[model samples]
Target: MIKYIGSKRALLPWITGTIQSIHHQVPIRTVVDLFSGSARVGHALKAKGFYVISNDLMTYAYILAQALVEADARTYSQERVQPILDRLQSLPPRQGWFTQDYCEKARYFQPKNGARIEAIREGLETEAGGDPLLRAILLTSLMLAADRVDSTTGIQMAYLKRWAPRAHNDLHLDYPPLLNGPGQALQGDALEVAAHLEADLFYLDPPYNQHSYLGNYHVWETLVRWDKPQTYGVANKRKDVQERKSPFNSKREAREAMQTLLGRIQAQHLVVSFNNEGFFAAEEIEEMLRHWGFVRRLTRPHARYVGARIGIYNPRGEKVGRVSHTENHEYLFVATHSRRVYNALSDHTEALQLSLF
Candidate 1:
């Protein structure tokens, strides 16, 4: 998947280790992804047999997560889905909501492709009506389908002047295996939501720096949820909700939210993910976690580019363009109320790597 943001999958092995260290004896009881952007973390946890709760402010995020985490996995033989996609491709263009949606400057999806997508969307909606689980199954397929034609590497924010090999050639989308619906999606503040959840261990990967997720990929939310309301800003992006502010985005508020959140968690262990780009210093986060009885463990993984743009160009007409990936590394912070857990983390700088020993 061309993820709109970085995926936690890259650090799963290490995160699992940190979780083992903190709650070695107790069962997961519950795992909460308070900012479940795409629910990657929550899905990973569920696949490992843990009960997962996912939350996100964006309705689209909620929709995507709901399908990925809590919904029952559906098995559609390739024969069953291939015809549907073919029928979708054969559908005629219409001045429907989809055309308007894709034609938006923010969406940047071509009218021809958008019409096919509209057919798929309508087909899925019609097929899944009245059943939440089935709705999620079809939705997961739709999201992947939408990604297939996206002009940007991943997001529609910046289109490349050309396309990469995979994107340029032909996009043949295979439906993602359905997992579950957005797990307990909440359209409120993450800090507020995190405070109320009780779990054995809580993993926090709140937004970092000034990049507003909605600003970059608002269309995905629109695609999955598709309210298609009046929008504003650079590319007619949806201006549906009031923005949520936290210390993570603006350094000024980052501390206050961190303080409030760190003070509220009742979990025995807390693992926070951040990077050097964060305005709050490592020492400050350590101090906050320490005050809450969570000794902090810091791990720095090798930084790599994850957010890449994929597109293709035609001989003359405008086509998809080059790939642009973001350059960044991950920082894992483990905090535990147990001194034994803290000592384990404090004693080893190699805690960042995934070594099952």
Candidate 2:
């Protein structure tokens, strides 16, 4: 998977353990990930023998879920997919719109690698044909390849003024570590999905702050959509970034949206992850969830993302502001109607090995 802002990679053990503990008390066969950003949590749950239904509003996120969560590795094994990858890799790099926009205009990637990205992406449209899963796998490969060579602090909001050492390396695609299972991926609003999708457990990881994922990852959006959309600003963000706003991104509307979404979700159990920097406080979220059942909260302190640690930088790449704080609190809330489920989580809390505060 590509580098993501709230990937939940470090916290996977705790997330999975909580679900497994709940499963120990009551069977949880199916889990619905309402915001499967990188599909890391969904993929982990699937690997633990849970049928996962992963949904996200972003097309690239949907693709990640398709490749990692929905597509069964037994059906689309590395052996079966490598031949197509080989063909894509052998294609001669061609300079095109991707080169002009991302390379020449914004400098997200080097011109050389950007040309390869264009060629491979264009070739994927033909090679993957009509198979959506195959298309997702190819896109995943291309996206990961691009990520390795991107000259940024793990975001597309801006590129490094000077090329990072990794930017000089040749772009290479490797097969993603897909698991053997059956799952589903949907692209839509979370509230809408929660209204209809019923499952044993529902995981909510909504946008916590004003920073939009689409704005941070506009390049990936364009790469997967292949829309060649009109862009603006020094970052060359898709114009839609301004137009496509989520209620969760609004301080005024976030609370109401969360309340409505919490009311609509139809699940036996719910696990939610929220940042301390988010619009709502942890106590406020607990209060909202208590309407459903008993809620238990766990807190983990971790370092902030690299971009925040690097402080504020101008377009010239000079640091212009002091770093406020380099750490963050990620709060996980588990809510269920059953008292036994809550006890099971509380009992297993010690075993989670996450230094919860």
Candidate 3:
């Protein structure tokens, strides 16, 4: 999987455990991942035998969800993946749009790797035989392969001026771990999707602050969209980056947005993931969730994302300063209409020595 900011990879154990605890009280047959960035949680849920509906507003995220959560294990066999890899490796080093901007100008990837990225992306669509799922798997492979050798400090907002060591490696593709189950991938406004979609549980993990995922991972978006969009600034970000904003990124609007989303979602149980650095305070989140159902909060001390630990760097790739905080408080709020489910989650938290309030 690609390295993503605010990814729940580190917190998966606790999250899955919490969900299992709730399942003990009330079976969660279907789950809707309202903001399935990277589809990490949704993939886990699918693996646990739940019919997962993963939704995200970003094209790249939708591709990820389709490849990992929606595609079944039997979809990608060696016969399917080997030929694509061979084709990618055999592609001539052509200076395409990806190379001109991201490689030669922005320096996000080495020229050699960028050329391969361009070649693979151009060839993937045709090779997939008009199957969206197959295209997703191929695109995901390219994205992950490019990310592994990217020179940035784990984000595309900016790139390291000097190539990182990993940038020297050749790009390669691997089969993404696809779960065996029925699942769906959606790309649109989560708020709008919530109104019509019904599920046994809804997992909400909206953007925490002003940092938008579109801005953070623009390269992937452009690659997946294959729009050859006009770009600007030192980062060579897509021109429409500014237009792709989420209300959850605004301090003034985040609370209201969350409240509106919670009110609209048709689900029996809600599991929300937010951190201490979010726009809303923990108490504010608890208060908002309480209106819909009985809410129980769980907190765990977590190491911040890898990018956070690498100190700060300007867009020009100059070292700026150090980050003060080395750790973050991750909050998992479980809101359920059932008292039994709430009590089970409460007991589960107590057993794990996690703080509950």
lDDT of 1: 0.64
lDDT (tens digit, per residue) of candidate 3 on 299-326: 8888887678888777665779878898
Better of 1 and 3 by lDDT: 3
Residue 311's C-alpha lDDT in candidate 2? Answer: 82
Pairwise TM-score winner, candidates 2 and 3: 2
Taken over the whole model, the C-alpha lDDT of each candidate is 0.64, 0.91, 0.86
**Candidate 3 global lDDT:** 0.86
- TM-score, model 2 to reference: 0.98
Deviating ranges (above 4 Å) for candidate 2: 354-357
- lDDT per residue for candidate 1 within 94-168, as digits (tens), equals 557767755544345656566666767766666655776556546666677667766665555554444433343
Report clashes for each candidate as comma-separated counts. 25, 0, 0
Ranking by lDDT: 2, 3, 1
Instruction: Specify the highest-lDDT model's number.
Output: 2
